[model samples]
Target chain A: MSWMHTIFALILLPAIATGMFRILRGPTAADRMMTAQLFGTCGVAILLLLSTGMGNPVLLDIALVFALLAALATITFVRRTWHGSNKRNHGNPL
Target chain B: MIYSILTLFDIILILTMLWLAWCLLNTEDIFKAVVLFISFGLLMALAWVRMRAPDVALAEAALGAGLTGPLFLSALRRMNRTRKGERRLDSDENREKEHKANQEQG
Candidate 1:
């Protein structure tokens, strides 16, 4: 059963790695941000799998924190960074 | 079987992290670099978990991925605004100098 969890975790790593390419070729800031969102989701999943695989329930708490922080980071980026830029710089397209 | 599988996972995780770090440093766009950095922090936390350091993983995810990313983004925005302001101020100063020279000539 632990092996199963480990295998699944291994499979997800490639998925996140492929998302890195999208970050690299992004034509806009939003695209790169979305890739980061994907990374957050995958990170949570991998953490959960590891918790069960290693028989250490403590990793579960780390996964929960990861999930929360990921959301916070995205909200900060959207509100403080992206939204403010458009409104504050009316004449410029920054 | 378990040993081999774990070894494979470790190898893949290390390679992915290395690639991400390389991209984060070399990317031309600061926004992309910030995003890559957040992702890298997340991966680094996972690496700590693999090393049986769950406490460190928690800290990395919270501080590195969560806090540092927003800080960088805000800093980037502020820097851009200030640079534009400075450029405009420079132009205004040049205009003032030209006006003063014209008055002196008159």
Candidate 2:
């Protein structure tokens, strides 16, 4: 049973790896931000699997923290970084 | 069998983290580098969990991925603004110099 949890966690590793390629070559800042979002979701899943496999309930809290913060990063990117750059494109103040 | 499987997982996780750090540090674009940094922090948190350090993992996820990412993004914006401001000042100085030269020539 423990092995199952670990195995499941191992399976998610490839998805994260593939996502890194997007981060490496993503043309737009938004693409890179979206990839980071993917990382947050996958990290949470991996943490949950490891928590169960190792029988450490504390990891669930870490997973919760990850979930809460992922959105925060994306919101900051859109509001502060992305919004300013797009002002010229619209030719109006946002 | 399970022990060996866990070891394999650990090895892969370590390798991935190293690769992420490498990419984040060397990327040409500041925005890409910052985004890569956020993901690297997320992986680092996972590594902390694997190492049986839940407290560290919680801190890493919250500060490393969450707070630091936005902090860097805002800093990048500030940097770009200052750069634009400097360029504008330079152009204004150049225009003043040109006007003085034209008056003297006329």
Candidate 3:
């Protein structure tokens, strides 16, 4: 792995560590959820860095999978948290 | 220098995971716990990558963090709804009891 890639990947660790505080202390579900989203994005970035740093194309594929899954997860969150099964029951959401 | 940096990263990642796990386990709020658990999953995935295991990292991100986090939150919301329903029922029962007591007194 080249120094540049190593540096790039190393930078994300502190960022992730910082995100943990919000997860621990967030006042609302939405705040915590946003930090969770941050994790997905940061994970994607770190994986990309690792793929390029290690010169392994397979890691890129893994990162792509993470990206897709992360989007799906976020969509699931939005659907459940905001648009839950309420619309079907005469607009009364529980 | 890179070796030292990587080792330092390993330490930080592990510590972060431990602290997040503690927070997840100790929080009174279920929603906060779910979020911390998800963050812990992400950190574990990163640790996998550091160990040169992209396959494990991929699985961790998909199943551990991404998929599980929202499911936990939704389940919590459902629990909240049930608790609210129980509270409403309890309040109605109390009202009925009060009515009965007033009728006996009168």
Candidate 4:
């Protein structure tokens, strides 16, 4: 409920927007993945800012879950890329 | 009155976030871009803390910046190798063509 929290929330908006642009415009798939991760990070920050502004504790749990899922998805992508390259190399002899 | 300091903190956080956004958008190399993205995550965590959300800060640091960044980088490295291999193959084929031409002439 503090003015400080409100101001912080407002500031985060444009930053989040910029990150979203990167997500949309990234040249490589990996760059897009990184941008998506940025989105997740910013989303968590937004939720936290809202939780503080609203004096609610429940949003903390949501943020925690989001973070876990984001990390898991990233790791999965990494594993898939590794396996994909390995398969390509095996078949092509290059 | 008391909120004035909070407002200042908010402005500072916002500026930092914007700087991060610029880096994420303009970085030339994918690897460096990924690193900047991770740093952006950490800065967002700090922003969350300044906003009084310690739980979110902890989660962002652990998952977003810590675990996710490296995962992406590793994946990028793997993908880079495949591209490199294709280029190598192309060069090899070119070399083979040159060798055949030389043998024919000799």
Per-model lDDT:
0.85, 0.84, 0.75, 0.66
Give the poorly placed runs of model 4, Cα more than 4 Å off: A81-86, A91-94, B1-106
How do the residues B12-82 of candidate 2 rate in per-residue lDDT, one tens digit apiece? 88998889888878877888888888888888888888787888888888898899999999889878866
Alpha carbon deviation, residue B62, candidate 2 (Å): 1.1
Expressed as tens digits, the lDDT of each residue in A1-94 for candidate 1 is 3889988888998999898888898787888898899999998998889788777899999989988888887888889778877766546756
The CAPRI-style docking tier of model 4 reads incorrect
For each candidate, give its TM-score against the true structure. 0.85, 0.85, 0.78, 0.45
Compare candidates 1 and 3 on DockQ and give the better one: 1
DockQ of 4: 0.06
Q: Measured by TM-score, how close is model 3 to the native structure?
A: 0.78
What DockQ class does candidate 1 belong to? Answer: medium
| Candidate 2 residue pairs that clash | none
Calculate DockQ per candidate and list them: 0.74, 0.70, 0.43, 0.06
Worst 10 residues of 4 chain B by lDDT: B81-90
lDDT of 1: 0.85
Best by DockQ: 1
- In order of TM-score, best first, we have 1, 2, 3, 4
Find the 10 residues in a row with the least total lDDT in model 3 chain A. Answer: A82-91
**Share of true Cα-Cα contacts across chains kept by each model:** 0.84, 0.79, 0.58, 0.00
- List of clashing residue pairs for candidate 3: none
Docking quality class, candidate 3: acceptable
Error of 3 at B46 (Å): 1.2
What's chain A's TM-score in each predicted model? 0.89, 0.89, 0.81, 0.79
Candidate 4 Cα deviation (angstroms), residue B50: 20
Better of 3 and 4 by DockQ: 3
